[model samples]
Each structure stands twice: as C-alpha cells, then as structure tokens.
Target: MQPTKRFDAIIVGARCAGAAAAMLMARQGMRVLALERGAYGSDTLSTHALMRGAVLLLARWGVLQRLVEAGTPAIRRVTFHYGAEAIPVDLSPGDGVDALYAPRRALLDSALVDAAWEAGAEIRHHHTVTALRHDQTGRVAGVVALDEAGREHAIAADLVVGADGAGSAVARLAGANVQEEAGHAATCLFGYFRGLPDTGTHWHYAPGAGAGRIPTNAGRHVVFVSVPQARFKAELRGDRLAALRRMLREDFPDLAETLGDARPDGELLAFAGRKGFLRQAAGPGWALIGDAGYFKDPITAHGITDALRDAALLADVATEGTPAAFVRFATRRDDLSLPLFRVTDEIAGYAWTLEEAKALHLKLNGAMKREFAALTAEVVS
Candidate 1:
C-alpha cells in the first residue's frame, strides 16, 4: 500500500522534545510532522524548572525570549536547607549566563510548538499514535495515528521519533530495550499557590522527606514535597492534602511558616515514584528522546534540561540523515545522561538519614562544580 502523505520525519509527542526536534529539522529544510495526543498548550505535571543547559538550548532556538516576555521569573540563587542549617549558592552557568528560569508548562510547551510551526513543520494536536508502521525490510516506515475525528490515519516518513515521554508508545511498539534502570525511591506531591513568598529557589531536607519552593510566572509559587512512598502512605492514610500540609509543617517548618495566608490555586497532584531508566534510544529508522529514552528523578529538576539537550543532539543527527546516525545519537545521549542520572538517584532516595543527606548533598554540589569547571575549560580552550 502506498501512503498518500510523506515527511522526512514523524515525531510523536509535541511538547519539549518533539516540538524542538521539528523546529530544528524544519529550519534545516526537512519535511517534518509533529503529533500530540493532547490539545496544544495544555498543562501537565512537571518540575517546570529549566536548568542551565536547557536555557542555553532555548536561547539557541530563539524561544527563551518568548518565555521571558511571557513573564517567567529568573531564579538567580538556590538555598539548600539541611536540618537547621541553610546554604546559599549562586547560580551562574558561565559564558555570561547569570540565572535560571522556571516557566509554567503551558507557556513553555506552547513556545516550542509555535517555534516549530513558524519553521514550517506540520503540527496536529489531538492526534494519538496508535502503533509503529514498518516495511517488509523490518525498518520503521511511519506511524498509525488516530485523529481527533476518531479516524485512523497512516502517515509515512523516513524516520520516526518517540519524544512521547517515559511510557512512550513508539518505544513500546519498537520494543526498545532498557539498558540501565534505577529503582523507585519516593512519592512526589506538588501544587501551585497564590500569595506565597519565595527567595529564589529554596530546598529543605530532613530525615525521611525533602521539599522545594520556586516562583513561576504570574507571581505564583510552586511547592513540592518528596518522601519515601511507603512512609507517605502510612502517614497519610489516603488523605493527601493533610499529609502534604503535615509534611510541610513537620519537615519544613520554615517553608511552612512562609505560607501564611497563601492559598492553593489548584488541586494537589501526586505521583508515585517510578524507576528511571535509559532505553536503547535508536534502532533502524526509529529514535527516542526526552523521557522516552532517558528519565531521572525530579529531585534534581533536570528533566527539561535533559530533554532539550537530547532534542538538539538528535536534531543534528537527523539533519545528517546517515545510516549510522541514530546509533551515534544513542551513544552521545548516554555519555551526557548517565552521570546526572546516578547523582539524581542518590538524592531521590528518601531513606537517607540527616547526616547521609548532608554528605550526599555535598557530593552532588562537588559533581556540579566539576562539570562547570570542565565546561569553562572547554570554552577557554
């Protein structure tokens, strides 16, 4: 059967990775198709903070200005609280980068999609990828997607990318192998609040739990709590809001005090810990990026950064469009991701005692320092 429509690439998931990939490839004069199951600009559960690496990529793609113009606040410092002590660290990503930014998912995802559209990529929201389509040679040829009208559509392409997320449909259909995995450690709960006060990005850690607060656009504060899943269940007895409030007051007293008259603006959302893993990112005509290929705990708030990095890296290979390009993309993705994954796993384990937590925190900071120094050396050389 001959397909009616064809593209250079078909990307499932139109959030950060897919949209960015489409934008980059389209800018390079490739015919790209991006599909998203959800409506455009919809919000999802995410840390929302963009690390230095992600910010740099956004700047390169010309989307950072759009985010800032939309009112995302700049986070210039980070304060870590371990028990009764507080340590403030300045966040400078070198090469004159002075601050980090956390924008609401709605704003950020839309910007990426807009960039892709402006670059001449075809985008279809409310389109779900039903399965991967393959040729007789066993290489992927395209995808089976269901459109908004509940009708099935066959879209052919030279390459198919699963930027769909941790539970990626394309990865599953392609049977991508998991090469490395870290076990689940904690449960995460978060909500947005109005009238809350913040001093940059703040983190608090105790024996069995950790919490953080950051200001986003519209002067809203995003607060989160991560605790051992078993302990969280036992303490809450299924009352999530009560458990969240108690976790704040008991484990993060200072952060709780700042709540004052702050009222929650949305329903409290909770997610159980899932092990993070690195999947075989590419095979034949298919490749994966974002949470689809590698996922780490949100404790480090590095998901968006990792996603943007891979999107850019994969886009480069896609531009080359060579037979071995996908394999090279997989190797490069692992080289950059494995170290941060291990570090984040250590921090996400909520079973650590106060002393162990402090030691681990120091180690994490040391790792970041070394990374920054290496970046500086590279730039200088």
Candidate 2:
C-alpha cells in the first residue's frame, strides 16, 4: 500500500474489531488498511476465553479448524455454581456452532490478524493514529499516524473506523454518545489457571459476588470473580490477589474451590474494566464495530463474540452499502446493540444483589436458565 493513498476504509486499533472489520472488508474486495498502536499480541491483558459464537466466526474463517489442530481447548458444557456445588449444563454446536474455547488471546489475536492478511487486508502494526483527518463537511476522510521513527504519515480512505476502544478517538470525532446513565457495573478481574478441571465449565453465583471458571484446551482454566465496583478501594488496587480473595470468599462463597489455590500470573487483569457501550456504529463516511460500537459484561465473556457479529454486519455494509452501507450499518447497530446493552446491565447488576444471587442456583427458573445459556451460546457461535 502506498503512503497517502486512498483506501476503501482506514481502521484504527487492529485487535478484535479492527482486525475483523479489515479482513471482512478486504474479503469483500475493499482496499482496507488496519493500524495498530500496540504490537499484535504483546502487552495484552485479556483472559482469552473466545466465546461459542466467536468460535463460529473462526470456523467460518477456517481458523477454528486450525485451532482444533493446534490443541486449543474446545469446551462443550457450562458449569454453574452456588456455594460449593457446581452443575454442568450441556449445549451442542448444532447447526455446526459448538460451545466455546480459550486460545490465549495473545496467541489467538495473531491468528485472527494473520487471517486478515490471508484474506488480503494490509495490517500495519505499531502504527498509532494520532488524529482523524476529516473533510470540510465533517465527513471522516482518514487518519494521521506516527510511525516508529516519529515521522508523521497520513493514510486516507473513504471511510474512517475507530476500533481504538473504550477511549475511542473516532467516536469522539463523530460525537458518539457513551452511556453515562449510572452504568453501575460489577467489579471484576480474571486470569488463567493451569490446574482446574476442563471437562465442564463453572458459574458460581453468590450474594453480591460470583465467579465463572472456564475449562480450556488442556487442564487450564480462566476464572472470573465479579464484585460491586463501589467496594474497590484505592489500597485494594495495590494488592490484586488479596482484593480478589476478599471478593471471592466474602462476596461469593460458591466459587471458593475455583478461587482457592489460584495464584495470579501478573499483578491484576483490569482494575476498572466495567464494559463500555457506544451510541453509534457508523456515520457519513465513518464506522465503528465490535467493542468500538458496543460492549457487554465479560462476565459472559462476550467481547470477542461481539467483534465477530459486528464484523459480519460491517462486511455486508462495506459491500452492499456501496457507499450507502454505512447508513444501514449504523442503523442496524443502533437497532441491535441497545437491547443487548440494557439486558446485560440488568444481569450484571443482579449478580451484585443478594436476592437475585440466591435464585441463581437450583431455584433458577427454566426461562432464566434457558435465556441465560442461550444468549451466551449465541454471542459465542
């Protein structure tokens, strides 16, 4: 690709959203350029539990077949826990969509990006977008990024996408509204553990606390412990494990075993990663997808799955929209993403309540259980 040359789209942030959008657009015969501020998979702090719905996208991209061959764990059941006991809920990948897997995002991110290249998207890593260059009419035109040498380079495109995430520059440029309406997200932190059972997954819910322990490809697992964000103290952030243990034992006792003997590999996963929900997905000549557009509680581990579906929809927009696709893409995102955001917020909030917490166990109705599992499965495959 030539410098200052125009492309069908210029995407910022090459992780999940940008990478998927780039590949999807490229595969659709669009000249796509993806820019990443960080090295492909280095310095990332994610639990890497690729959801079942995301697995479907990888399968469609043929990477799932490769992952299976690579020894990544394929999970087929979910384990729900309250107190000391856990129950496994069986779900099939009928219609060819299996359960879920944890491929170590550090490793899996590279695979997705590489697939983008195979599909013909030009990936430019370590290239951070400094600013968005818009036309006089306030239409997004491209981005100006700084390279390793500190030189300024401009990459122009018809559509400018901001997948930069959380603190999105493109979103700021487009005047996208973030949900400031008392998010009240539960506090959470998770990491990979090497000795947990992988035969089935686990969901341990307790009053104002809970943990989701997922079995990976090997004997490895990733455990997520969520608590009320209000309890997080300035000092607790200084000691992640101690803080984590408190949330586990005091808040949710159901996850004791999974939480016990689990030593963290690093300091902490995220001290304040209450998910962000974007208000828009596209504009006149700009678009946002995946986390750039909407995010749900990773308590369900829906980040990557959101990226997959957003990619599919954006790909269609890139092709059929033939310039008008941006409108339809944004509209579709506006229509589909809000309901998900509202419901997940309710679900996350309930986990922080003792009343709802008690009902998460055997008392949970068939409707709640079915909807819960079905939604998680949908986000994954």
Candidate 3:
C-alpha cells in the first residue's frame, strides 16, 4: 500500500544512534520517523559503560539528567590492573558532566527515545524495515516496513538512515561498500552482579584474557570477561557459566576474587565473535550512522561514545541531502573514527604479553590524546 505520509527523514533502528539523529533533526523542525524492530525501553547487548565523550553528548542533548534520574551512578575513576600492578586514572569531569555513567540500555535508550519524541520525531516500536524504496533514478526514497500487526507500511522520506547495527539491513539495501574491516579476534561473556563492591570501573588484563568491572544502577556492577577466540571456544563448550567461572579463576584470579560475594542477576550473555567494520557512510539519498556505518571491537569500550559522536556529526549535514554534504559527513566521520578503530583492533586481538599489554596501553592513551586534539582543532577551524 502506498502511504500518504512522508517525512523529512526516516531512521531505521530506534536505539542510541537513530534516536539521537531523530532528536537532532527534529530539533531543527524537520519531520522525522524512527522505526525499531524491538519494543520500546527494552534492553540489548552492551557493556553499558559510557565514556566521557558520550556523557558530554548526552548532556548536550539534555538527556543525561534523565539517565541520572533513572538511577545511574557517577563513575569517577578507571583502574587498569596488569597482574600485581594497578594503574588508576582519575577522570576530570567538567562542563555539564560531573562524572561518567553506565546506565542500563533500557534506561539509556528509552531516555533517548523520549528525547526524540519530545523533539517531534514519531517513533514506532516493533516495526521492522523489510526493504528500501527507491526512485526511478536509483536513489533511495525511503523504506518498506512491517509493524507489530504484520501490516505493511510504505513509508516515504527524503532520506533513510540505517542505525540498525553491525548487520544492517539498510546498508544491504543501499549497497553501501565495506571500506574496511578487522576480522573476529575475541569473545566476551558479561552479566550484572549484585553485591559487587565498587563505584568505579576496573579492568584487569592478562596474556590472552581480560575482565572489566563497571558500576551501574541499582547497586549492581556489569562484569565482562573477554578471551581470545581459541580459548573462548575451548572453554565455552559446555555449561557456559561454569566455563566463565573457570576462565576467570584460571586467567583472572583477582577479578574472580572480587566477585566472591556477588551473585549474578541474570544469565550471562555471551558474545563469541568480534569484528570491526567501516562502511560507506552516505550515498545518494541514503546515509548510515552508528554500527551500520562504522564498528569497532568492544574491547576498548568505545562503541557507545562513537555512536553518539557520529550521530551528531551525521545529523549536522545529512538533512540537506546534498551529495557534497554527505561527502563532508563521511569525511569527518572517518577523521574522527579511524584512529580509535586502529587502536581498538590492536587491543582486541588479545595477543600480547604483560609488558606488551602495558606498552599498548600507553600507546592507546597517546592515540586518545591525538583523537581529542584533532576534534578540538576541527571545532576551532
């Protein structure tokens, strides 16, 4: 059925990136439609740690307060443990941010969706985009979607955005090229635990495995253990939780000890494959944001921040629908993303000795400094 309604933009995926883009464009008084394949306020797989950059963007979007109100605590320090040595880095919060946060995805994504609605974006949950609608000249016109009732809707828009995730349907429909990819390296298992004793985030790294403890809401901490693919396969053969316990005890005894009194709040979630890809960000009347356009291994815990940053960047130029604007957006996204992508790929490989890990850690810090410096320079220019 041909729909009578059209929007300035139709964004697929109502999660962090899509909602942020919708909110930004609607703030400019553009009519926007956001579609999600899942229910509103539901959760997805995430480490749930918010870096300073993401926190800054949330504050700018006026949604950080909502997350804080949702019971997310402030994280002030990040500690990296390499065997007996502990390196702690204190985060200096300025501007509107007092500290970092790792809110549950339910809280964080729901807040962003609310912000999008408040900005006048129409959001439809449980609606999946099945195909892209194209013009005779071969430009993307919009999307064909399926609602909860299994009814088909022909939603037309000036631009279509694929924020659906790494395996993005919009990208497939738009024929976006995979500019680069870092193949799978490691796997991760994570869960929330009650009685975890910390307000800050901690990371312990060993030769082929690593663990992260990040404090989140409701006095629960999100803990994850990452191992090389080989170890992950050998260990996760049967009884997954028991396998995780064994991995932690054998490779990360200190982290295992820290969880002695804590019990898991739910089943442990496993992510056995990790890859990073950079796809074409914009082409014709279609553009991509978040994971659809760029993805990095989660070992660096930069996914959320990168999504937020690119949403803002893409929103600034995408509404125009000009080829020049799309190229500009793609350029800026690459400039901001490539450095961290390289660093994350290296770290996610999990192929380093203790001394090598320490060296790479320092290198990562340097790369972060350079990235921020470039961003600052861009703002000045």
Best by TM-score: 3
TM-score of each: 0.94, 0.86, 0.96
Residue-level lDDT of model 1, residues 1-381, one tens digit each, is: 346589999999999888999998899899999999999999988998887767767876789999989988889998989988898988755654578899999899999999999999999999999988889999999999989999888899999999999999999999999999987667788888877765799988988788989889999988889887787677665756677788899889888888654667757888788889999989988999999999888888888877887888788889777778877778767876787888788878776878888788777666555544443343110
Best by lDDT: 3
Summarize candidate 3's per-residue lDDT along 1-381 as a digit string, tens digits.
Answer: 886498989999999999999999899888999999999999999878887678877887789999888889888888999976888988875655579899999998989999999999999999999999988999989899999999999988999999999999999989999898885567899888888777489999988888889999899988889987887878887676787778788878888888884668768889977588999998988989998899888888888887888888878886567899889989988877887887778888877888998888788777666654544345310
Q: What does each candidate score in C-alpha RMSD?
A: 2.4, 4.1, 1.8
lDDT of the candidates, in the order given: 0.84, 0.68, 0.85
Which regions in candidate 3 have their CA more than 4 angstroms from the true location? 370-381
Off by over 4 Å in 1: 237-239, 365-381
TM-score of the candidate numbered 3?
A: 0.96
Residue 325 error, candidate 1, Å? 1.8
Q: What lDDT is reached at residue 72 by model 3?
A: 90
Candidate 2 lDDT (Cα, whole model)? Answer: 0.68
Local accuracy of candidate 2 as per-residue lDDT tens digits, 1-381: 235888988888888778877877888899989988888776465556675556767777777776677688777787666555556678755546766777776666777788889989999888878777778988778888998787899788888888887677778877876643326576677766676656666777766555777765456677677766665544265677776776777756656555577675566675464655655677777777766667666555566766766777777767555556677666656555555555556666754454455443333233333433444454322
